[model samples]
Target: MQVRHERPMSELSYQVSAPLKLTLEAGQIVTIKHWSLDRIDYPEAVDILPKSGLLSIPFQGVDIQFFVEFETDTQDTYLKFKNLTGRQRETLAIFYRSILSGKMVSTGDMITSLDTPVDLVPMGETDDEKASDTARASPQFLRVIWNVAFYLILSVVVFGLIGQQIWTRISQVSLMHARVVAPLVEHRNTDAAYVDEILVAIGDEVQRGQTLIRLNLPEHDAKLTDIRGRISAAETRLQALENTRQVHLNTGDPTRRVLLQAYNQTVASLNDRNFFSGRDLDDVINAWHDLRDFDDLARLAKGPFYDILRGLDVEIQAQNDALGRLKRELGNHKDAMDAVDIVATTAGTILQIDVFEDQYIARGMLAITIEENRPRMVRAWLSEEMSQTVHIGMQSRIRFSEAGQTRSVMGTISDIQASIDPDISDDFGIIVSVAFNDMNVTQTRHTFRTNAPVTLSASKDWADFGSLIGLER
Candidate 1:
């Protein structure tokens, strides 16, 4: 809050010795070697770099000038020598000339000064070329030195401008990175049925786990018919024998009556409930029938004579189960011709269907896709350097290229590492999640279910810069 200004510092000597012609730019801090306040020959002044302010104070045995930049009403100045060991109040008073000049003198009369005095070599050199004219014409080596000095001065000015621009560019920084995806599900039981016929062509809408196609077994019907016929024949013969044998038994024929009656009763027992003597008669027909005769009649009689079947329904269930397993296995083949039943796995609008019903498909085929529900989650990783700067409950903005719309979202920094990549990785990035904020897409199209990539930007901490802006009261 205090105001002060720089006064030029010079290394005083009666002789003018501008050796080396080393140049230092404005605002750059450089060391003055071979010069100290302790030297009598060097006097009390320092060789200040151009544009720097210096204060002279009596030190040890000499008046020592230390470099500093003084502040005016509201501007900043980098005081070169932060701390000084000279007499404090005396040195402060001597450098207070500019402050007094501004307060006491009129603007037109006051001397314009800050860095100009440093160009004067205290060893008897001045900026006025006219005053030094007599000195300039004296010697051949002196003329040469003068010309060299002028070239050296021009060179310093040229390089300084270039160096400043280079520094500014180097100070600029930006951030961007490649995205990492979180796979929705690791594995799936893709092997499934297709009962409802898939109506649309490829790229048709299909929900997750929705039934798509139905598989049919053309041979299932013929086998059903043959098993039924045998059951009916067995029952009819047993019935006729039962009526005749009972009458003979009454006429005193004991052996024939026993055999005939036993047969009729056994037939009755077999027709009880499609479970004939603990055996599946359908299976029996299947296993023992003639392949060429085509057992349609027997299979057709199944329901009517179901009561007389064998294997007690277990064998029948086994056959059905075996057929089911086969249908499931065929789904893996892209060239499957069998009918099937496919169902949707998740709740979503079907996006597309790649294949049609009655069409053969192969294993691991792309059937269709679904665009999932809302409140999409986007993830990003921050560098280890920013781990501390970023924290939970920070706000972020996102813009999707396809949608061409902006979205404002709040983020909760769930995790942060003490160091980058604690182990496996050489570079570490902390994971963060950005939750959507009241942002809705009227347009229905989206790239993927919940995971959509978009450009992102983060708000940085600007408290220090804010001080310069007068935001902090």
Candidate 2:
């Protein structure tokens, strides 16, 4: 073998002194400069060479064969042997070994022509004897190993799941007949009335004092009308009394009349300025009385006109008081009419709205129901035997549905009470209530309103392995 001036690829690969002629099954002839047991290097245009085909190297009295594949590298183009038969591989190894041992070799001569006898090392044996000596197992043995590995992994998984179910049966208590609940509020019609308007719909969020429905009470209409009529009559009577008093004053003595006119002017001036103080009016009245008395004393006389003026004053005062009372009664009637607007007493979402416009509802009739906007809870009934496993402040998981999806929220047993009704106690069980955790309460407050069904599972602190083994714990 000739030492190549280029980089050495492997110890077995040799640079040939002369180019070796090779032919492809596709009828293309080529020359190779370097060859090894596994591959060959040749200078050829990659485009002209077949990608893969049978390759033949002419030797003395025989043709050495290989299946070659064309490949390109960054530095050069070459062909690698593909699907080499055992005999072809061994023949190539002998040729390479013979040349390495200082024997003259030529591709044109038979391999036996060499003076040295070359022993063919088995294909794929390495220099390390320990590794080469290891015998490869048959396909049947490999299949058995893979089957054993698969069964071992499957057995572990199956046993692990069975153990988990067994543990849960011992340590957990599941309550299935549970429901989500919150504080509820009811809206009842307080008086006999026809529903005039419904201001809210079911599922509407409302605030305290928000008007929910408007009722028009037919009974209030007659009372309001009567009060209004009385007020109108009282106002008319008051105006008529003022006319009669003016006429009565006109018939009084001129002196008294002049004094009355002057007093009236002063009162009008005070009232026009919104200065209705009693002290100002009293001062004017006192001055007038003093002037009238002085005048009467100076004249040394008293007249029927004074008596008439006093009587008119008394009558007008009585009329004014009556008018004032009538006006107050009118206001009270109006307030009763306004009370027909039913308002929310607590903030919440409206749940049931049974009344519609123009529908007559009686006094104390059920009209609407509201679910208060408070933290939701889950309620369940536990039997006496199962109740022993549950306690207040115990952790639980509450499962419910929202928008067609199942959800789980963590909660704690907040209350446990004996069934109040003897029928319920004998028929069902004890009452247990669960309060949701803060994180879940805020998110699902509206999602689970009153009476929404749920499933509650409370896990105990201790595991009862004896129970799983059919022994009492």
lDDT string, candidate 2, 1-473, tens digits: 35433445654355443345577666777776676656677666565545666556545556666655556433455556665555566656666555556464455344443333444567864668766577676699889999999999999999999998977667778875688776678889888899998989987999999989988877687887887888788888888888988987666577665777777676666764445545556657765786678587646545666677677788889988988888888888777777767899999888799788999888898898988777778888788677677889989998878788998878999998866434224555778888888755455564775577788988786654555567786
lDDT of 2: 0.72
lDDT of each: 0.42, 0.72
lDDT of 1 by residue, 1-473 (tens): 13433242453212211111112334433333221222211222444323333434322344445454322211131222333333432333333333344343333322222222332235665678557675644688888999999999999998998997765334311123413232232112144433236543433445555554454333433443443454455455555555544553355424334545554555455555665455646543433333313335445533333333433344445545554554444443323433234455554455455666555555456665544443345566557665545555555555454456554343333334444433223565665555555534323234324435555555544443454355763
Question: lDDT at 118 for candidate 2?
Answer: 48
Backbone clashes for every candidate come to: 67, 0
Give the poorly placed runs of model 1, Cα more than 4 Å off. Answer: 1-196, 199-209, 213-341, 352-362, 384-392, 400-431, 440-453, 460-473
Candidate 1 TM-score to native:
0.30
